[model samples]
Target: MERAGFWSRLWALLLDGLMITIPLNLIWFMYQGEWTNNITQGWAWDIVYAAYMTILPVIWNGYVIGKRVLTIQIRKEGDQPVGLLQMFIREIIGKLFLGIATFGIASIISAFMIAFREDKRAIHDKLARTYVKNRI
Candidate 1:
């Protein structure tokens, strides 16, 4: 039940972000013939990102694509699998709200918390009473 390290978690998140971005960019390119128009579709992308974070982990047993690839999983406080409600709280309330309110500044802070905190719990993880751990 060892907590996942900050670097590992950061790389996983980047992978997930890329997973979302690459497809969207390709679709935009095919439809609009350009990939540089991301700003105009930021809101739509955010919604997709929110859905990605919330639904995937619950359906995938606490592992998003990135987490699965990285051999890490999100778990409840007692090392149990995350419930749907927990995923909602973590991804919607904690991540989505903070991401929008601060224009993604809060996510940066969450990374710092994970990096420096003894428990390696980011704000979202603390809010959801969840932690990322190396999958057994």
Candidate 2:
């Protein structure tokens, strides 16, 4: 299987942020009649979106909504399906916490790794022992 490109993966994530996260946050704002303190996170919809990202691929054969749209998939090494704990490590621990803890340096390194690595695996992918593959 071919690896997904960095640009495609970046675009897919942007699409998810725009198409899903933003809209859901907007709906929550409308219902609450007030903006959230953070606006982008620390809200119910953010948690829901995080859960969606972390959980959907495990059960949905590696495709989240944006990944599905972009024809890419997250999989473990050897092209096996990802699992719950691995997804949790990838999305929550490796990406979120480490990204935050490192002052975004890890995120920048991940971008480079995804762009430069032959397998297109990011730091989070390495941490979780997973990678994104191009389905097209």
Candidate 3:
């Protein structure tokens, strides 16, 4: 079967984010009544989201609940199961650039490149040595 492309993977991520946002926001509200009232609480929620994004992919064989629902899984370039270290690097370090303006620009370029690149790898995927593929 053909590999999944960058857009497909991005669509899956958007769906995943939508799935998690409600519960995460609710948890944040329980910790602090409003998002602006407590910086520490906001940071705490960020940590939780980070941990969820990072650890779930590793433990679930690269399919977080969203990806699983989308029938996609992350794997190494040669189709090996993704390891924890790779997941950490991918979900943490690779995605960290997303918060910075310059890095965001870089991300756009990287994403466009990934769309047409032969290996079908986004910047995070290249850095982490991973790919998202349709589950067999």
Candidate 4:
């Protein structure tokens, strides 16, 4: 498997944002009986989004919506597919909490790391012992 480049990872993330938000907003509308930017209103939305990120790959053989669309996948250094604990570490602990603790600086640096590093791993991937690579 070849490592995914920065641009593919970046585009997958943008697609993932749309893949997550639209359904979340629709569910918010269903539950709240209205649509008023509810997906951005609270921490619950964040948890839901994080859950979406954390859970899907484990169940889908390293495919969440955007990664599937982009033909990339998350896997360990040994090329094994990620599991739930790894995904939780990668998404919740590594990305969200660490990003918050560092005031987004870690995330900014992670982007650069992905762009420049030969392995294309960000902080979260390193934390989870994971990497993104081309599907083929």
Candidate 5:
């Protein structure tokens, strides 16, 4: 299986960001009964982001909405199913933990790793021992 290239993965990320944002925005609207307040000021957005990353791949065969559209999927190093533990490490530890504590600096480093590293493994994938593979 071919490894997914950085640009393709980046596009997939953008798409997934949009997908996550839309529903989150709606939830904010319904909760606050307004559309202008900042949702990032609290833990709601963070929780949503964590759940989106962790839960989706576990239930969807490693294919989040963007990965599904981009013909890419996350897998164990040897093409195994992504375990819940792996998902938790990747999503919660690698993304949410670093994102919160570092104010996204660590996530930025992960982006650079994806852009320049030979295997295109981000910090999350490295921590989880996973890879994103092109489906076709």
Candidate 6:
């Protein structure tokens, strides 16, 4: 399979974020009957949402709904199935840093670097020893 391009991978990420966010927000609102404006609560929700986003692909062989739709799957550097520990580290550490930038500036820069790197890896991908590839 061909390596997935940066734009394609980015689109998949955005799609995944939306897929996770909409439902999570809906559930949060349903439970609370209004949008919760508390920063602490928001942060708590972020933690929950992050876990939801991270755990699924890690456990499911890297084919989250967005990735499945985009015909992309994440694998280890050698194209093997990504291990749980690697996924945990990637999600908790790498993704958390990407999220800290809010508008994905960090992710964009990382993607650009990945595009030129010998290994074809984004920052998160590098840190986790993972790569997103087109599904055959």
- Give per-candidate clash totals: 0, 0, 0, 0, 0, 0
- TM-score: the better of candidates 3 and 5: 5
Off by over 4 Å in 1: 37-41, 102-105
Which TM-score value belongs to model 2?
0.88
- Runs off by more than 4 Å, candidate 3: 28-42, 98-101
lDDT of 4 by residue, 1-136 (tens): 5899899998998999888788877887898888766575579878878998999999999988889999999997799989999999999999999999999999999999999998899999999999999986
Give me candidate 4's TM-score against the actual structure. Answer: 0.92
Q: Which candidate number maximizes TM-score? A: 4
Q: Give the TM-score comparing model 3 with the true structure, all chains together.
A: 0.79
Taking the tens digit of each residue's C-alpha lDDT, what string does model 1 give over 1-136? 5899899988998999888888888887898887764633667877888888898888888999899999999999998889889999999989989777999998999989998988999889989999999875
Candidate 1 global lDDT: 0.88
lDDT of 2 at 100: 81
Model 6 lowest lDDT segment of ten: 36-45
Q: Provide the TM-score for each candidate, comma-separated.
A: 0.87, 0.88, 0.79, 0.92, 0.87, 0.78
User: Compared with the true structure, what per-residue lDDT tens digits does model 3 show for residues 1-136?
Assistant: 5667776777877877666677666677888786543432556656766787788887888888777877888897788888888887787777764535464876787678668987677777878998888775
- The candidate maximizing lDDT is 4
Candidate 2, 1-136: lDDT as tens digits: 7999899999889887777757766786899987654656566655777788899999899988789999999998888999999999999999888988999999999999999999899999999999999887
Between candidates 1 and 3, the one scoring higher on TM-score is 1
What are the per-model C-alpha RMSD values against the true structure?
2.1, 2.1, 3.2, 1.4, 1.9, 3.4
Q: 1-136, model 6: which lDDT tens digit per residue?
A: 5878777777887897777667766777898887643522557767875676577777888877788899988898777987777777677767776658556776667778767776567777778888888886
Off by over 4 Å in 6: 35-41, 98-106
Question: Which 10 consecutive residues of model 1 have the lowest summed lDDT?
Answer: 34-43
